[model samples]
Target chain A: MINKLRMGAAGAVFAAALAGTPAFAADNADATATAEILESIDVTLVSGTSLDFGAMVVTGAGTVSLDASTGNLDCSDADIVCSGATDIAEFSVDTASDGRTLQINLPSSVNLLRAGGTAGNAADELVLDGFNSDAAYDAVNDEYTLVYDASGTNEFAVAGDLTFDGSEGPGVYNGTFNVSVEYN
Target chain B: MIRLAASRLSCFLACLAAAGTFGIALPVSAQGDLLVAPTRVILDGRRGTEVILSNIGSEEATYRIGIELRRMTSEGQLVEVSREEANELEQAAMRMVRYAPRRITLPPGQPQAVRLSARPAVELPDGEYRVHMSFRAIPKPQPVEEQAEQAQGIKIKLIPIYGVTIPVIIRHGRLQATVALSDPGIVTGEKQKWFQLTMQREGESSTYGEIRVMKRGNSEPVYMVRGVAIYPEVGERRVTLPLSSEQAAALKGPVRIEYREMPEAGGALIAALETAIG
Candidate 1:
């Protein structure tokens, strides 16, 4: 009987503990400051120019690689017509923090799927290699140090080589990739 | 040249003064490419709140702001979700959150306010709803020269986009939560030791607070983690916090682990547990 009474008492205590305290009484959980400190950062990448490998008329199957450093293209030995502008992809970063050092995150390579060229409109296989940052500070891995100027602006461009299959489709091929920036 | 409002100018000066006085380069403006204030929002069905977003960049930029779903992992990291992955509760939560100025274009040093409001259905159940509002930077069009340089053969384009998100929560009537700490253990990894604690949450709402571990006879806590959230999605979660070498060594004795609601969040004693460690 005594043990039973003790168990009952413990159960009551447990119930009270579970009830604990009324938390939302005043709707006073105003964690605005902490949240602001943790979040609210924004980094924008504005594209100045797309990485244009120019026009290439392929006579035979071969690879065309673009030098990330100079945006120059090296066509395979196959007879090809190179025309138009061969320019690197231009990007500028705008941050709220002026003159702050940031780490830019870019993928080393991305597969740009050709639109409507694949079976059932699936992504066609096109690989972009050698993601490069134009900043004097070399990228440690795929991340580079972005130094904003006094006006809170930093411009960096990424260049890559495009690998194409022998029989390539002639359409407006488009694909999207993600680049992120954060305070190091 | 951009003009700052008198109040904003004062805030800027004050921030600079504070940074100088503290001697620590507080990540005021230098940390983020974008500046947003009022990081989290809590709506009680009164009026809508405005989240201020500013473009601190040098050139013109466009940003897309939208509400996204996120689920908190046991490790306290938020995982973003796609629409198809959202459950019924998450879908309902998304339906209630309303925000405007979905898209904005601003020049350097320009600020805009995105108004957010929660309009819950009258018959909706009493619970806490949450959505992560994302502000993603959109890339402008390629320059004329680059556009004209389009190649005839297989070409590839890779554009990088960046952004941030904050949680907006809405609480309806008469919600409660019960928090209990269990299965406290010490985990030793290759390079670090961590204190793992499992919090069991039972109720309609979530619990937000600080987790503190104090050694007996010591006034100061040996381990403390802030912004710990026990969201309503899970009935229980295991929270693993890395322990400093000193803290891990000190934990070889009797300790008290408590999950207390943040003072800003109401200063309530959510849960407490005492254990002996070797």
Candidate 2:
């Protein structure tokens, strides 16, 4: 019985050693495997205010321009009517991923047409030309450095001029343009 | 429609020169202040999802929302694409998406939603489609100065527009992707040492997962990265992750490298490999 026990113990030890050799060898080769991970994200941006260019009256063959900085209006000599209640376009951003920098993209210009009407002539159209924005951006370089504040918010403003031809018809003019935001 | 001359903002500089203190405030280009949520979106037979845009700046802003195309390079950089360059799968993806109110104007401290829905065609081939939604700031116009400058031949407008973009993805029917880690290496260059990982993919569709490196006997990973994407553009991609000196030193022996889905989605183990480094 004693001899049998000793032989069994030797056999067990040898078996354990052999089993360990493969794991050590496996470590020598590069390890490789695959993993499947579902992807999802919860991001949302809310609009709190709308861009108000204010109300304006078109005079004769002159232009009515709005200052982006002061939100003031400048009507040319051909102007017949004018109102000075223009407001700069404003936006505020909120996100769960606070402190991440974002970039804003805006069109260089936009056109305003007489409301519910097509281009009749020069008098039927006006242009919002040359935009000066508060957001730090370089149209040439296409770069931005925008970040949310500690409270998970980032705000910006857009100001542009509204130009009318010498004889813009008397009516409300509306137009639509594009703005894009991205993580820098 | 008003025939507006789309002029750049640089024309305003000339105005400042001519009209000294003309009561017109100049454009004060400050750092961009905008917020967007869920940097990425994945829609798979789910209801419509909403992306929120908020203006965090002190002033009100108008953001024009539009869908743009971007293709991921092997190095994980997104390169913009034009409609003419879109592939068949990419084109199909665009047709399946429907978003409302392309333009949103907001005041300071206000937020707006761009609702998005995926309308896949019946019997559509199983694959992944994506589009990048962008929110850009529309600069206020400087009319009087621009026209005056145009008359004077000083047309140098510098309207700096800034915004953000996020990936909106849709998956249709029986799509599978396999992700693996290989070529584990430690590279030191430019006065920095980084742990480099080679992520490999197989099968159809794309894989978006996180990479984690943990030493033996440690429950937590020493280094981890989320939002690692292995798009269908490449079968293999090499990503370099910066590591502190201490973390690099701790990585001298055997370490377990794991690639898993986002933890929010249960972080299931897709593939794992053992890498021994010195």
Candidate 3:
């Protein structure tokens, strides 16, 4: 009888120990997940030109957004300030027929706004507009005001020269837009 | 032209600063690089473009930069492109052109290809894309064993190759969203600065989506925001949170934007965007 009583007491203690494990594990997982979530960022598009999908934008959300869902980013030589072509977050054009291409190389200087809600974690759209070349620097109000414009669509004239009557030749050409984001 | 692969405007201005014809030498480390000033091109359904290429080498070096499009696996490892299969590619990516310097011998203080070119296509979406270039010395065939022995003593033949590859980007599109800024207008006082965030997306054929952005305790955002989408759109959208007057006043030097991403294309999750806001 004494031995039975000892076994019963031990069983009760063991059951209590088991009962605490789930709560402990859940708390640990929740804490870890919260920490991870705190240190994350999300990126998405807003407005401008047309979204032809020349490049891909990644986000913290759960879904993939396609360029077709977006519009075109429009800016040209008329806007002396570097716009449209220069502020591209990312791209993949190797070079043009004439050996000219553009690229973005920043040594960690700026930050981009991101989406934090659960609505479109799937994806966010981007619009590259509000390009006014008159401003040499990125305008405080505009995100890409300082970006350079080098796309053929702007001042590039990226194909064979067209002639109304006599002009000819110099058909193939290349172009690129370069700009720097220097932070003080 | 000291370094052709560098910025055209910068180089031109530097030349003028040195009194037009007087010469300006570049740092030794800046030599033999095929630098594409603005490493990306954004087209508004347009075609034909140009950029600049230069030999940033301190000494006379030859440049035969090879440009091609390779496939990126889900793991993010680049699959070397085979020239034979280059015949098939996206239509917009067809009209590719680069400085075909059969051999560009740039002097210690000279630049070349003052103007480069590009030809854009009109039928594509707005998102991010990638392309690579190899700027190393072309490998020469090795001599036969007997040919080597026949040469003086031990025919010592060595070819030192040098190259630096760069990724080119193309962003095109329009985006509009209601940004929820922590502060309406980012204001700073007492030698302080704050950070705001934005996002851009290029087009498809891309394989990345999903990212995360966050900061330490302070004013915790109710939801988590993502910095990069495997393929974000090709436009800019604002997502800012105002820094309280107190935080701005106590600010030291820089605000940080630390982010991480898990590319659907495959590979370990890595830091996608890390910028400073001051």
Worst 10-residue lDDT window for candidate 2 chain B reads B1-10
Give the top-scoring candidate (lDDT): 1
How much TM-score does chain B earn in each model? 0.79, 0.79, 0.45
- Residue pairs that clash (backbone atoms under 3 angstroms), model 1: A29-B265, A42-B34, A54-B151, A95-B33, A96-B33, A97-B29, A179-B160, A179-B161
Chain A TM-score relative to the true structure, per candidate: 0.60, 0.59, 0.17
> What does candidate 3's lDDT look like per residue over B98-149, in tens digits?
3345456655334433223344446655533344544443333334442223
> How close to the true structure is residue B174 of candidate 3, measured as C-alpha lDDT?
56
DockQ ranking, best first: 1, 2, 3
Locate the minimum summed-lDDT window of 10 residues in model 1 chain B: B23-32
Q: Candidate 3, overall lDDT?
A: 0.28
Regions of candidate 3 where Cα sits further than 4 Å from its true position: A1-184, B1-36, B39-52, B86-92, B96-103, B121-130, B137-156, B170-215, B218-278
**Superposed Cα deviation of residue B27, candidate 1 (Å):** 9.3
Query: Where does candidate 2 chain A have its weakest 10-residue lDDT segment?
Result: A1-10
- Report the C-alpha displacement of residue A167, candidate 3, in angstroms: 64
Q: For each candidate, give its TM-score against the true structure.
A: 0.58, 0.54, 0.32
Q: In terms of TM-score, how similar is model 3 to the real structure?
A: 0.32
Model 2: how far is A65 from its true place, Å?
A: 35
